[model samples]
Target chain A: MLKNVFVLALIVVLTLPGCTMEKKEKEQGYTARDELLGTEIIINIKNSKEAPGACDDIFERIKQIQGKMTVHNIESEIAILNANAGVKKVSLSQDTYNVLQEALTLSSLTGGAFDPTVGPLVKLWGFDSKNFGVPTDKEIQDKLNLVDYRQLQIEKSRDTFMAMLPRDGQAVDLGGIAKGYAGDEAKRILLSHGIKQGIINLGGNIVAVGTKEGGSAWRVGIQNPLAPRGTFLGILQLKDKAVVTSGGYERYFYENGNRYHHIIDPQTGFPSESDLLSVTIIANQSLMSDALSTGVFVMGLYKGLELMEELEGVEAIFVTRDKKVFITSGIRDIFQLIDGDFSYEQYK
Target chain B: MTVILVMNNINKWITGGLIVLAGLSFIVLYIYQGSQDHGQPVLVIYKNGALYQKLNLTKDLHKEFNVTSGGHFNTIEIKGKAVRIKEADCPRKICVHTGWLHKPGQIAVCMPNRLKISIEGRSDNVDDISF
Candidate 1:
């Protein structure tokens, strides 16, 4: 105890003058904020606490951003965009315009597999209202008729966007890709605030910014399909990478021992019957991960694996119905299968 | 006499318990490492209309032959260490990447020829694959 006290006093005495001498040590270079996207949003930012106003400033900025993008925000630009689907030529904020552009681009890239106009299909399935129940065949078919993304056109030159139905009257749904697009924009807003080292988990799509300190990689745990919560297969170490997981388990309804999920195949207008239960995609761009997660899930295993292999920077982990595990070559090393009596196999 | 006797009894009991615990720990560790050794493979041969056979690659590895009996041509290639696939013949080229089934979960699917080769591992026992 005497030796420890002597060392402590010596350290304090030695540091006291240095602390007073260094006058400009309080300025930090990190800030963060969170904005509610629709009804749910999870935002985390890590920065130096020396800057007192950075946190509050970031938080307020996020709220302001959400006010423009969230569809649930009644006066939000997105809500206005959705409300005036076919009528007046409404001008849009630059942020909203940029997000819509990305949404349209991703929808085209997936060949309509990841359509943002899935709002009608989602609502028909009762998933949009936070209700995880199935609708009838007629309802699905009717909604399917309203779910063509090609009809959702954006005339940016006129600052006008329209969701034109193929027939006389059909509504457009931008639910599938809006949250992800919003999350990406929110990250941009935070970055513009000079905030780095943060994660934006809107619904299930996640966008991480910058890299963590100490050169340590961020280990994101993938949710197990069979496990209720908190249980994970293994950790994937990421550095400025976004990981998005789509699974039947995330949202499903059990009726008469048959389970129906939120992910519907556009070709069938019903839940995908693919053997895969869940798929998680890791990409540098959060939007790609978001769009690819849904596209790959609907494509099933064969085409999904091929697409993953064809892409340069994308890696995926697929869980099949029989609990079989398949991982892309990019992430085979980092994934560790835990707590399961299953076999760890790689598709060459 | 009583004090000496109590101390002696306590020492013996503690020593015996430690020895038992150490032995049990070793036994458990050995079983755990040994239990992960299950290999099962499914090799599916695609033909005209029916799937020919689902062979277990874990049980057999060096089995090979040709896929030509008539003028119908199907290109076969080995892509990886233990995966082989048939490139073309008809509809789906899924078997093109299957290579030869050497690793677990490695599959060869012939889309046009309707052949599928899959190597399955010990996954049935796992109730869930968590994130």
Candidate 2:
């Protein structure tokens, strides 16, 4: 009896310190939010305002990236590439070259399921301009012919790089990967600016700098695919990782009781007919997570699962239209389902 | 003596079981406490990513306000718990189409006008951004 009491007392004593330790490490971090990169940018820093100019420097880098990669910007490198399609190879900065290369790799990895060259299809569907109009069958077919990631060719020189779009009117859209790149840059800038721990939320792309206060895992809510932005089906307790979800609900239009979303399929030249409502990917790098989320989202569940299985250091949580949650084996313990309506089926 | 020993064993068993049960309940309670909603909903408006205004949604009020950013004006309407963009000078009218923002975590963005309205912290921070 005495021994049992001692053991119980020991356990209590051991566990009691953690609560106070957590309280001691608690720091009222700074939070700043901005509307840049066509998304909300929320930054949280624990304990100090060591670098007040860090945000300005970080946002400047983001804007520079946006200006470089956006096809909309006439002076942007991407716009120059689109202009020279089938005419000439446009010179690209190292940043543009690297992102384009990574995008091409992800495109092949997902079997063209997520194509950067799906710009024509995206435009025809009226998503880029948000006109909310459907393209004619002939128009889709014509655009589909031009929607090939393979056709975006690259040639590297000593100092600079050049890229060619094989067909005229073919364009490359870095929407899928640019934000992730921007997020990583933000992380680098924050670290350089003397901020030890932070959370960089560039719209949907979340790059957790370090663990929350007291070395506890940050509780990041997984947005419910069917509900509003803040409504979540689950919470991912994570530290020092990027959690990105590409949902069919992000941009959609309802016409005649039918919901048409913005994730255009490279094959069908329309929105992907995937049964999935959202795909949340957890990865070490924000860029890969950003690209893979879109790729897995476009690939649908089966192929997406197969791809994730082959890849190393990546886990995914797929939410279907019926609200059934399917998570990879890795995230089982890490992901907690908060919403009782959504059920997570354990895959064999 | 034998009866006394038996009673002590029973006492130990019950106490051990109760300790384990208490430990389990504490863990469960800790987790439950972590995800609980923090407070009532607050309507937060952002212009160019900065907090422009924060209004309590529970307040019984109906007012339409215009936020001008970079020469663009977005007319925002807040009535009770529901808030929305009633009108905007922007061409897309996407903010108007965002319909109504009632629930916590819902956000309506007027991209061209650089205006965004979001319901502020009533619960846990976003763990995994779904969209």
Candidate 3:
């Protein structure tokens, strides 16, 4: 103890004069903030000469995506398709076709766990409106008939693109995958601006561009579902990847002590009833990880694990309701537990 | 001789018991530290999933405002550190039911109106942001 105290005192004495020495860092990259898609979007760059101009361009790109994809916007491509649902085939814009096509591919991969056609069910449950109420079994079943990706017909060519939903009651909402596309597009803009390293946080969809300044891997926190927001269960060390999580705590309603969230299961017309509380997906593209997070969440532990195994370039961390965390092989080495109570277990 | 053996056994049990107590206290301390909110609370309001405004909850007294978007209207009232949606034209009074927002990171969203309000702690110096 005496030797330790002596060393501590010596360190303090040696550092005392340096306390007044302040050095300001130049080339501190810009972080432009704006409200997009009903969430705060922050774009941070490591080093930049034209901070304002680059940030303006990044925000502009996000705005364009939001305008084209937002379902509520009457002039948006999605709105046009939704307006013509079950009526006629409507030609889609280039961006809409790509996002829709990606959603379709993801839907097929997850077996409809993450569907774009659940709009009708989302509306019936009043998740789309302020008239939120519980829906009857008959009501859910009726809407479920319209909520099939198979019924969402797609026709495309080099110059023109069109899509049609089978029935009039059916609708399409791309809330799940659009943000991922936004993150990916923003990354493109940042790279074009000569941003070698940066962080794009579009709400919870975090996309790390390259590595951090000085060549350190980005450390991302995973939300603790059972606790308040911003409280994390652990950290994920990643480089040039997007980390997205899907959980009930972000957006949900509690009625009679039962929690109902926006992620409706395509099989059932209600909030998914699964043993899992949250699922975090990491991948090269934010769109893939964002959509897969929800897809895996609805698929639950076993089937979700199967989905992760089949897909390449994808890693997942599944947190169950009982506070157990299961990690995919890719994340095993990089996953660091912040909360001691939660154990990271591997399952075959 | 038997008494001496019993005393020695009791001494061994005490040492083990002290180690166990230390372990339990360490766990409790860790939990207590994790539960603390490190920074000052700020109110952040979102519309259509984008941040519309951010206000310091501890300053400037009361601030009342109306958010109008796409023909939908919701009136927000902030008194001191608590905030709530006073009135909304949406069908269900879910936002109102959300009550007050006092704790940092607690969120109240009126999805129908495309309005969301959340309290942010000023001192949450996290290197990574979670979705």
Looking at every candidate separately, what fraction of the true A–B Cα contacts under 8 Å does it contain? 0.07, 0.48, 0.37
lDDT of each residue in A12-108, candidate 3, tens digit only = 5544433322222344566778878766788877555766777898889888988988876899888888888868999988888988899999999
Candidates 2 and 3: which is better by lDDT? 2
List-wise, what DockQ does each model earn? Answer: 0.03, 0.26, 0.16
> Please, what are the lDDT tens digits per residue for candidate 2 over residues A8-113?
7776775675466466547456676666667778777764656557887887889899999987778999989988888998899999999999999999998898
Structure candidate 2, residue pairs in collision? A34-B49, A35-B49, A220-B126, A220-B127, A220-B128, A221-B126, A221-B127, A221-B128, A230-B105
Worst 10 residues of 2 chain A by lDDT: A20-29
> In terms of TM-score, which candidate is stronger, 1 or 3?
3
Q: What TM-score, computed on C-alpha atoms, does each candidate reach?
A: 0.60, 0.82, 0.75
Per-model C-alpha RMSD: 19.1, 7.4, 12.2
Residue-pair clashes per candidate: 24, 9, 12
Task: Estimate candidate 2's alpha-carbon lDDT, on a 0 to 1 scale.
Answer: 0.82
Interface RMSD to the true structure, each candidate: 17.0, 5.8, 10.4
Superposed by TM-score, candidate 3 places the C-alpha of residue A167 at a distance from the truth, in angstroms, of 2.2
The TM-score that candidate 3 achieves is: 0.75
How far does residue B78 in candidate 2 sit from its true spot (Å)? Answer: 4.9
Sort all candidates by lDDT, best to worst: 2, 3, 1
Chain B TM-score of candidate 2 stands at 0.67
Candidate number with greatest lDDT: 2
